[model samples]
Every structure is written in structure tokens, then in C-alpha cells.
Target: MKKLLTASAFLTATSLLGMVGNAQAATISALTGYSTMGGASTGMQVRVTFADNTTSTGVWSAVDFYSGAASADGWTLFQSGDTFGNPWTFSNNSSKTISSLFINAIAGSTLFDRTNPNPGTTGSAAGWDFTPVSGSSPTSFTYSNIVNLVGQPAVGDLYAALTINWDSGFSTGSNLSFIADTDSAISVIDPSNPQPVPVPAAFIGIGLAGAFLAKKEISRRQKSHKA
Candidate 1:
């Protein structure tokens, strides 16, 4: 009986430890965009990276003027040359469950506008924004009504891309990019800082050792009681 109880206690501790190790948070770095124009053509790239070291790349399409439209669905209004809008969405494809979400955006070589003049200017654009959706349980995230760019470019053509990333509790990485054109190559915009993963092997070793000791102690107690 003593040995049985000791072994049971050890097993319980091991189980609890496993549960604690399973509960961890996920992270997403940010999205970066770049564009260049030569003659009458333009090129652009959008890159996104996740916490687990996964990445996604996208190319931007030809520059188009925006049409005056109100923000609706999951899209937000953004403008650069003329008036252009961008809308974004998110989905989870990892085997491991997700605990949280993070997102960031960087504009290279030019800045796009979301409000005011509506029709954004042609210059370097940079900013970061974050919003939590559905507490902790969310499988898909979507944002629409991004930006609508109106007037056409007076000089060279324009291009842009959007990247999205997420973190899932398991050791997995994923990315998605929305490309407008393919002239530009997607590069690592912002690299993520390395993170440590939980070691199940170590936990298992410690648990087995503890269980053995417990069983030994139980056996000794039983012998003493019988004597």
C-alpha cells in the first residue's frame, strides 16, 4: 500500500508538469513592404515572419487610383498615390493551438495614408498597429476596408504588398502574403528574436526518476511495518 501511494503521487506530479508545459503563448513579428519604379513600370514586395521562424512573401500589383468608399467588413482605408485601400484577414493553419496574436506593418521607400486627404502621398511610409480579437480563442482573423487609392501616378507606376503572421502554441510557423505585382522580390522586413521551446524530454526523465524513488521508498516502509 505504501509503495502504491508513493508511485501514485509521483505520477500525479508528472501529469501536472506536462499540463503546465503545454500551456504557452504564441507570437508574430511584423509585416514589411517596399516598392521601386523605373521608366513606366514598378515593382514591390511584402514580407511577413512569425515567432516560430516561418515566413511568407508577396508581390504588389500595378498602382491604381482609389475610389471614395467607406470602411466596411474587415478592410481599412489606406492611400498612397491617388487613393488606394488595403484590407486584411487572418487564418490559423497550425497543428498546435494558438494562445494570442500579434501584427505589425512597415512601409519602405514610401508612406501610404489612411485618413485626411484620403489620396496618400508618394514617400516613405511606416507605422505599427495592434488589436486583440476574441479574447484567446480565435481560429481566423480578418480586416477589410483597408485603403482606397484614387488618382493615377503622374510619373512612374506604383506597387505594394501586404504580409500577415501569427503564433500557435506548438512548434510551428506560417505566413501569408498578398501581392499586387511580381517585379519586386519579398525580403525579410523584420526578423524575429529567437525564443526557447519547452523540453518534453527533460520533463519525462525527471518524472521517471521521481517515480522510481517513490516506489523504492514505499517498498521500504512496507517492510518496516510488517517487521
Candidate 2:
């Protein structure tokens, strides 16, 4: 009977885990100050390093990661040694345009620390490769996959002072603001005036002359009729 009960418990646990996996899965990041550029239309791969030395890669919507004012928009990725593990890597292919990316890893809260001295790293089209921001001791260190423009991967080594936490129930992590097209200026045409067709000087002059001649001809005809 004891063995039977044990078996039943295991089966029940397995079923629950399966259901969790099948679900959309909780977010790793919060939606407080969640702001995105380029409509967060692009999708990027987010990889997590598990404690067992195994890793899992999943495609996450760039908009899910929020970046805005330093005081707001901070989210947590994982706990020090949670199920998702520590240390993560983000990669975007040529298909996606990532103009500017800023990652700040701090200790206080799981949310990103834009105000802290350790503003983790900055990623560009060249690659996700970056060093410490000038004069700051960063807890999280990141390396790039390759220095190529075609495909760049930003690998963040969160194996530092801050205790990494992985809450499977969360949407995403940190105060991450990704500007897909920061280098280029987006010029939105005014909807009110989608197209402003300017009248040419010659066309205006021709229109005025025609109106004047028509009025003069009408007056002459009227005078002749009266005579």
C-alpha cells in the first residue's frame, strides 16, 4: 500500500509539472515601466544556464523586456540558484534590428539597476560584446559569441555578487530597454496631411490669368449685347 501511495504521488507531481510546462509560463519580467521601441516586434533568443550545467534556449518577445526611467521598469530574471539557474545569454539575428541595449546587474533588487555604477553591458549590431562601463565595478560580466554584424549574441555572465534568481512564474527580467532602430530617426508622416502637394508657381500664374481673361471676355460680351 505504501508503494502504491508513493507511485500515485509521483504521478500526480509529474502531471502538475507537465501542465506548467504546457502553459504560457509565468513571466520573468514585470510590466510596470515596460516600454519598448520598434514595437518590440522582433523576437530574440534568451538562454538560461541551469545548475546541472545544462542550458535551455527560448524565444522571447523583445517587448517583454522593459527599459525606461532608472527608477521604474525593473524586473527579475532568476534567483541565485533557482530552477532556471543563473547566467543568461541574449542573441538577435540579422532578421531583428537591435539598435541599443543596456543591461545593469546589481545586488539590491532583482530589477535592473540603471542608477548603479555597474551598468552591466551594452550590445550593438557589431555584437553583444562589451566591457565594464568606464569607472564601475560590475557584478555581472558578459561576453560575445562572435564579433560579426550578421549575427551577434550577447552572453551575460551573472555569476557575480548579485544572487541570481529564476522565477519560472515571471514574464522576463530587469530594466531592459531595447531600441531596435536607435541609430536611425523615425520620421512619421503627419496623418492629417499624408501628402502635401504644393501648387507650382507657373500653375498658379496660369490659373489667375485664365480667370482674369474669362471675366474680361464676359464683361465685353455683356456690353456688346446691351449696345
Candidate 3:
């Protein structure tokens, strides 16, 4: 709900994540983080972190995303301190079903409305409903309360809990989400960036020192021969 992210001044790319293994302690990672004025966005509106396996030691883990900010980036984009609901779509196999769904937000009972991804035929979900998403096979869910058929739900302090049995362990995989403009794309976060995330400048300095010493050794050898 606070401390949003902004592109320092750049653009990069990666591949969509593939299905994860059913291995215990399978890691759940944020493949890609973006703010799409017209696409699926992933990440937490509030400060979020991970909890140990929801099942047991080394099993399905809980990505506990919670916090109640009076006001957050419910909507809007591009610029300093921007905000949005930030709906997320983790790596899904299209076969595995989310075992459990939990949502407990104190909305502060404030009137709120947000049509982030879309108004999507005004629907509603009780915080306790495990199938808040509806249907067995689901790729995504647009959480909202239909006050007006094409309006955003009025509420804050959003909460949700989901359990998924990834076919494989959480590793490199593909991700998919919607976007508004053609400029948007379906990309993934390559933690294993083929082009390594650059090293520190201090490391570069050390490398330069090594090269200088090597060059000095050769120069001294030439001078010794003349002597």
C-alpha cells in the first residue's frame, strides 16, 4: 500500500515461467513486477513477505501479503509515488487448482471503487469464500463489488490467501498477464539473468589492479634484458 516502484529509466526483458514441480518447499518467486494501465499487474499493494510452508516444513508456503493503509496506489500510473491495486498472477499450470483462498481486509469500511484490470461484469466475493475466484479452472480473478455494473469496488485493506500444488518445484517458469496497449508484453523475471546483474564497482577496481600489475611485470622484464 506504500512505497511503490518506479522504472529508474530503463526497459529489459525475460521469458515466461513454466509450471513448477510438486516438490516440497517449492519456492514462490515474483517473476515479473510491472504497472500496466491496461494489463495484468503482479506484486502487493501492501508490504508483503513470505512465511514458511503452509502445509508443513518444506511444503506449500504462505506468501503473507497484508497491511492496512488508509490510502494506497489503488489506481493511476507513471510518475513519482504512483499507486494501483496490483493484481498478481503467479506461475500456473492451468491444471492445478488453488486449494484454499483467504481474504481478510479491514476495509476501514470506507467507500472505495476500483476497476483496475476491468470492471468485468460486476461480481462480488465474501472474504471467507475459498472459491472467491469462482469455478474450478481459473487463470485470474478481478475482485470487486458491483455497486454499478461497470465500477470499481469500494473498499481498502485488501487481503487474500491461496494454496496451489505446483506440478514441479518453483524454478524458472513462464508467466502471463493482460495489458492495455500494444507496447505492453507478456514477460517473466529471469532471476538467472543470462546477462548477469552487474557486479560492484569495487570488483572492477580490483580487476584493473590485476591488469596493471601484469603489465608492469612485462615492462620490468624488458628493461632487465637491456641492463
Name the candidate that leads on TM-score.
1
Better of 1 and 2 by lDDT: 1
Candidate 2 residue runs with Cα over 4 Å from true position: 1-41, 62-139, 146-227
Query: For all candidates, what are the clash counts?
Result: 43, 18, 28
- Measured by lDDT, the strongest candidate is 1
> How would you encode candidate 1's per-residue C-alpha lDDT over 1-227 as one tens digit per residue?
11032333333221211101112221112112222221112222333343444544333333443211112222222222221112122333544333323221212222222212212223312111111111222222221112212332211122122222223431233222111111112232222221222233211222455446434533443454466
**What TM-score does prediction 1 earn?**
0.23
Worst 10 residues of 1 by lDDT: 14-23
TM-scores for candidates 1 onward, in order: 0.23, 0.21, 0.19
Task: Name the TM-score of candidate 2.
Answer: 0.21
Question: Regarding TM-score, does 1 or 2 come out ahead?
Answer: 1
Of the two candidates 1 and 3, the one with more favorable lDDT, higher being better, is: 1
**Candidate 3 TM-score versus the reference:** 0.19
- Give the whole-model CA lDDT for all candidates, comma-separated: 0.25, 0.20, 0.20
lDDT of 2 at 37: 28
